[model samples]
Target: MMRLERGSSRLYAMMLILAVVVLLADQLTKFWAVSTLSDSERIAVIPPLIHFRLLYNAGAAFSIGAGATWVFALAAAAAVIGILYTARRLASTGWALVLGVLLGGAVSHLGDRLFREPGFARGHVVDFIDYGPFVGNVADIALTCGCAAMLLLSLRGVPLAKTPEEETA
Candidate 1:
């Protein structure tokens, strides 16, 4: 039991490290994109398949909101809070890792919205990396993968919530 506890501790540390690395990489890549690409301009890395297309998204994934920057910012904040709360409750290493990734990605994009273009929380998220029709960023990829991981875990019967009765039982 002691050994298992140690192992779990190590796993948690590893997950935290992975999250930090993801956040750093995402931020760095975004900085590069902002510095290199002009707004709304695309530089093709591979014609029609992959390109570094600079875009400002004032909405959720795929620019869903289109112009409601404040709403998106609020939503991102709520997501970050929810993820952090979930992370605190996570016992499984896999869940921790997934939450970490999701949190990191959220933080990265949220940072951009708070500090980048258009001013304060009214700012837009900078997105690049156009693969054919879809354009996203490193943070977006992390969020997607994290969400997928959580979904997979849920599908595989990994319990996400533990009630008081279950804990006592």
Candidate 2:
């Protein structure tokens, strides 16, 4: 295992960049989807593998809690705040990257929930990019992958706590 200094500056910088990139990419793609694709329209990019489509989801994953968009928005906002609060204890490179993407994804969805269409705090999220029967957006992809990475890291016993030096600080 590579020894990392407590409260590593480099890790934090990397995490910040990753977070910005994820957020920008998610929003930009959604903008592109809205401008280019009609609702429920699909354009196959690869046979049986990938396609582009436009969908508005006013619910959580798989359309769960379909009528509780505002509740989801509030939950997402809280998650973002919680992640930032825990970031100070971040130590591993793996954890940093995962958390960064998670934060970006959460915040991006929160933005859509707050600002995108039908009404405030109950706006639907713009989703595109389809894999067979599964449709999701950039933020969803990032969030899924990040969560998977965190799970794997945990399984491998990667510690997320700060070092002794950081504890003293």
Candidate 3:
């Protein structure tokens, strides 16, 4: 097994912390939405723009593949695994942060699918915060931001880790 250097360890710690924060925020907000909001009522935060409404989504974005909740659950599990695998060699702080947020959101959704109502591996995701087009939860926000950051970092030619050739140079 490749041991992490001190800096790499610190980066991993930061990533873990960020992921925990995102997971907590997502869960707490979902709890609040479930307790306070009603499915039948839309609480407008900004008239015709933003609203708070309870939504139980069993599928991916925009309710696509509604009938395949298990598929989404499996996909999320696979994504979490992939992210963790990538983290093993991470050498960039930016990548650490982005992956942390992404991991958190993915884990949150996976948890919802595995544990929350209906049945195991077929539970619906709790979502609120209507953005005039789609309703999503905190996890979605984190995922979106993380993805954007990932894209930006990639565009800037930031490497996730130093290649063997680069390290020797």
Q: What TM-score would each prediction reach against the true structure? A: 0.83, 0.90, 0.94
* Model 2 pairs whose backbones collide: none
lDDT of each: 0.77, 0.87, 0.91
- Residue-wise C-alpha lDDT for candidate 2, range 1-169, written one tens digit per residue: 2344456656666676788899999999999999999976889899779999899999998888879999999999999988776666678899889988998899999999999888899999988998976789999999999999999999999987686776567
TM-score of model 1 vs. true structure: 0.83
| Regions of candidate 3 where Cα sits further than 4 Å from its true position | 164-169
What value does the lDDT take at residue 47 in candidate 3?
88
Whole-model lDDT, candidate 3? 0.91
lDDT (Cα, tens digit) per residue for candidate 3, span 28-108: 999999999888889989988999999999999999998999999999999899987777667799999999999999999
Q: Order the candidates by TM-score, highest first — what do you get?
A: 3, 2, 1
Q: Give the TM-score of candidate 2.
A: 0.90
Give a tens-digit lDDT track for model 1, residues 89-126: 34577777887788788888888888877799888777
Better of 1 and 3 by lDDT: 3
